[model samples]
Target: MQNKAIDFKRQVNIKLADTKLQDALSRLQTRFVEGRSAVISEIHHLEDTRTAAAAIRDCVLNDLDSWLQKFEQQAIAHGAIVHWAETATDANRIVTEIAAQHNVLTAVKSKSMVSEECGLNDALEHAGIKVMETDLGEYILQLAHEAPSHIVAPVVHKNKEEISDLFAEKHQMSRKTGIAELCLEAREILRPAFLNADMGISGANFLIAETGSVLIVTNEGNGRLVTTLPRVHVAITGIEKVVPTLEDVTTLLRLLPRSATGQSITNYVSVLTGNKDAKAHDGPEHFHIILLDNGRSSLIGGEMQEMLRCIRCGACMNHCPVYQNIGGHAYGWVYPGPMGSILTPLLSGLKSSPDLPNASTFCGACAAVCPVKIPLPDLLRNLRTRQMALGLKSRQEVLMLKVWGWLTLHPRIYALATKIGVRILAMMGGERHLLHTLPGATGWTDGRDFPAPSGKTFREMYRKKSTK
Candidate 1:
């Protein structure tokens, strides 16, 4: 993962400077914004649903242990083999063992973020299994040998032309310019992989404890096919995905799609109960469920426990200004955006991902749009504090912040520094009241001009007013 982080940062720096990537990201971001706005505008009870969803998630988190046990019992009764994986290694071993038992040479998979979290694809491929991604976005990324750039829209960073070029190169297909044509081409190429796969892997959207069912919501029909067509089906989910009942799952269903893609409901919503019975026409013969702990259990009683409430809706990322500017690869993980800022450090370890939590501007846009009400900015700050305690912050930044803190504590020094700074900026800007370039202000001035501070400090005016 550490190596992946470094590689991701390098890729993002290259991708950010590419004009094609910028244009693609801009168009994609705009579509999401407009679509979500349209949905919110039409839905009169959006906020109420968000509140109700948040409450449901909160209740599940509060009683996670009980719910997990109940879910396991129900799933076993429904003929699903339930496996508890307390670590990534455990999770990988469980999946690989299942695949080996079935002599699975090829596996067809839907987009499961939990699988990404566990590095399941690479693990299986390493064990000599062929893994094929069925999602169109995921397929594009797989061909490019890249991780997902966004949670919902995995290849949001790629333009159609880029995809056309990739397909022509990778699959020897003709250059297709139309979006629908490209999708059709991918579908045709993946259809064979699906029919030949010995195992199917998918991520659960929500796990219903009452009935021990795995719920998956997707726009493409591939998710349904992947789970039902193969001889063996495996569902990978995080511990946090468990809910008390189908009713609780309904509350999340109302908010997730609107926050995610501005749709009232995704095109396909599948509820799977264990394996197919003898009378069932079509379904997997064997069913397995891997519940991943992966450090999430530790967070249950900690300060950042609220983060477990995230539904992976990608709303926080969609609305975040930082994510809008830099995109997901900049955060360098399976998760990105505001939710990623908090989750990456907790799951990946704070010392390695110090830059992630500090990447936010704390503008609170993420929290405002989050349907589950995760306090992203606050959690990021908390992670930053923890990082500092661990001495993971750079020396220069620490010193700078300490000096700033000291000056702010001393009113006289702060006032004097502000006056001097204002006068210097005013002199530099002259009548324009703006600076295009300033020493020690390169980061701020690189893209946008900085407005010069007023000649007089607010403290001076306030002092005069008080005296009068």
Candidate 2:
């Protein structure tokens, strides 16, 4: 996938102007955010659960190499093959090779985020293999040729009416206005794909090092089907997903579904250990797990290591003000919202995605709701610091910051400048008292007006209070 993250502001502009996209994103907050808030109280001790979850993830990050090795040894012992990938391209190539080796005709996917990061669909198509997305949101995106807007809810940028139209056109069937009718149409169309697909691909929620099992939770039963029925199954996930034990997985599961979809438990929780046994007649014949680094290893023992704790729950984005307006596509990558804002630049290159670090309001809402207690705001600030240190900021912005720093050093002059600037702003406002446009800030006022200062500066107010 060509990265549009480089065009952050441009994409944001387009997403903001799109009222339909706005309406679609609003539903994300209503359904996910409100639902999460309502269900969190059900946890015996929400904070304690979050703490335990964070500790388990941090424990893995502390010794990720050992756990991954343990997982590999255990998985292989159980008849599953483990592959390591240093880059997204490497992971894609590995998957393609496996598909070719098996003479796979059709590949059915179960919404793997790492696959999106690896551009596996494009790579498979390039290799002359047919790829089918089994997950409903991913299937919709596969038909639309659009990237996902959110991590958990990939098709949040789309509404039912638009999906209905797409389904009718893509399925080449008569339009179905009702949601149930459209779902049935998709099911009928996809059932054949499930039965005929030679290979299955999915993303793992947690890789239990103790049992060497690939655990994934889904409301839709496609995860189970994609792993089964097909002769070959491939599970791809970031190396950070590995945990020490199933008990740790059990702890994380308490937070994942609740934070992601507000469900106390997902309808289907599949723990796939390996291929079918000689005595058994079910499960995939060949099971492969791809552990993708893709820049994750570099963050180990660093300022950004906390980022690896992410479970793709997407609570950060659901409550994000920026995401609520611009949606995920504006982030210009598969990962979106606060997590994407940090991950895109970290996993991809900062030079390619310079605007992502600054795409936040520093609201800390993302950090507050993060189930694993990732300090997202602090990490975002770290990226901004790195961005500035690397000369990623424009000359004008750098100069402005320098000037502001100098003014801060001289309080009297800074106070005088602010006082005069406010008076000038007030004069410009006239009777309307709203500044439609201001100096040095362009396009910002295009959408809304800024209120002119109505009183003295904070310093002046403080001095007056002291005198009183």
lDDT of 2: 0.91
Q: Which candidate number maximizes lDDT?
A: 2
RMSD of 1: 1.9
lDDT of 2 by residue, 158-191 (tens): 9899999999888899999998897788889999
Cα lDDT over the full model 1? 0.87
TM-scores for all candidates?
Answer: 0.95, 0.98
Candidate 1, residues 1-468, lDDT tens digits: the string is: 332443444555576687876786687668777677778656568778778888888888898999999999999999999999998889989999999999999999999998888888889999999999999999999999998978999999888888999999998968898999999999898998888899999999999999999999999999988998999999999999988878888878877888899898899989899899999888999999999999999899789999999999898888887778777787878898889878887887776666788778899988988888888889988888887888888888789889999999999999999999899998988788999998964867876788988788998889889999
Using TM-score, give the best candidate's number. 2
Residue pairs in clash, model 2:
none
Total residue pair clashes for candidate 2: 0
lDDT of 2 at 405: 100
